[model samples]
Target: MEGVVVRRVIPSDNSCLFNAVGYVMEHNKDKAPELRQVIAAAVASDPTKYNEAFLGKRNEEYCSWIMDPEKWGGAIELSILSEYYGREIAAYDIQTTRCDLYGQEKKYNERVMLIYDGLHYDALAMTPVESAPEEFDQTIFPVDYKRSIGPAEELALNMAKDAHRKRSYTDTSNFTLRCGVCQIGVIGQKEAVEHAQATGHVNFQEYR
Candidate 1:
């Protein structure tokens, strides 16, 4: 693998899965409704295939719940989206740090990468990404949940975390105020100024 890079950050709201997929595919936030519709429609159209056993709810009910902005998406939704888009969905499962590409025909070369960190799903893409890891290197990663992660992969994940921490969450400068008090994004300039106004610590940097 060349390297991993973040293309976008979907909000941490419950609608994150749909929003993340939409952001990755369309570079915007408007496709969630359409994606949800496709998932619900597909599920409703075939109850046997997407039954309560698989979905944990009646087809119609699951469809309804998934469409709600508050409901979270999972493997079932991911499959539906992959089929609807006719593109492979690449997922970086954060718990295992395993990158799995999901699709049937493998006819389309285009792919959408999503990162699932147990609680949240985010959009991300890797550099020099291949259809499979072995396509670039001979390493075969075991998917065993009980196994420990290797040093190199662990380092890569740590590096990704550190980089994300250093980078601004928002690309737009207007939304972020880099505080001179501390370089990290948690406290914006306005907050810094407010603190200064309240206490006399007046060092601030406009990040935008």
Candidate 2:
């Protein structure tokens, strides 16, 4: 991750984010044209919003607090670009807001790990601490890092596995499809099963 630059996103950087959207579309060529247009609109309007919407669509709480900055302190939108597998990737465009946990502890570093834990998936680590020591301070807090996974299918499978593992005993056969095409599952009971049936996908097996 050396030479990797993490900077705040600005209106001027929209083009770069737009290119990232293009890269995503090109990578997931099987995605529907209408879905691509909707995504393009979101990306073109605001990369931060696009990122939030994407996460929201997946039902992730990562970006759900963007609307209320008061509850989560200030919000920051950032983009990370790096070279992987001989290609440059828009590693992440995360929107994070700080929250004061109910604890007397100070000067403690909080770490959060996001595991793909799916077939052909990748694992990512996020922390509230900045990677650069010089950038660490009281005013500046690293909320979260938005790491990119490969494709929609991989993302879906990962989500599905997580859903199943979380609720194996209760309604193990039901789940919600977060991403329409991705088919990311969220375990539920009868409601989840109905949702899956509505989506026309019934493959709910444990992650190997």
Candidate 3:
């Protein structure tokens, strides 16, 4: 059978990263809470490694923040989870059409795939056919599986291009947002973060 890499959409909940990782790792999409706990514990257990300089917040504060179900996970979480799972995670960025491999420096023998479309994350799996059952999915691949990895990267690039053509990604650097609390207009992620820091308004809606 000619296997193909397919992008599996994950729910747009705040924990999409964890859910995507969960789906790719265990074929279960509901492991967000458990994964969040894993990240929190990992952070708490190593303050020197996950310090405020790296976390952008106090280690303890970051741990508590990560454990919140509504909080989103990103690079820091990815690194911690990569160490926890002892496998590399290749996250294909739809905006940049680039693959960032977590745990690559760790020299892991296996890796899983995820697609990041700026605002959300999804899983990538190799299947026998487009309509193959999830149980038949192959999300983990050996690092030395050059043939599989090559095609998987191609598929991810194609998916990224398609998403780009659809303008389906949030341009964090240049998007306009309105704070849901104070209803103030802010431009880009930087401004939004500044507004949030000043007013404690964590809720925002993107606008054209």
Q: Which candidate has the top score in lDDT?
A: 3
Q: What is candidate 2's CA lDDT for residue 153?
A: 22
lDDT of 1 by residue, 30-121 (tens): 67777888889999999899888888778888988888875667788887887877776766665455566666454554566676654567
Residue 52 local lDDT, model 2: 50
What value of lDDT does candidate 1 attain over all alpha carbons? 0.61
| Residue pairs clashing, model 2 | none
Task: Please state the error at residue 192 of candidate 1 in Å.
Answer: 37
Give the TM-scores of the predictions, in the order they appear. 0.58, 0.16, 0.91
**Rank by TM-score, descending?**
3, 1, 2
TM-score of structure candidate 2: 0.16
Q: Model 2 — which ten-residue stretch has the worst lDDT?
A: 77-86
lDDT (tens digit, per residue) of candidate 3 on 40-118: 9998998998889999999999988898887899998898889999999999888888888899888888889998888
Better of 1 and 3 by lDDT: 3
> What's the TM for model 3?
0.91
Q: What is the lDDT of residue 33 in candidate 2?
A: 33
Off by over 4 Å in 2: 1-38, 42-114, 117-208
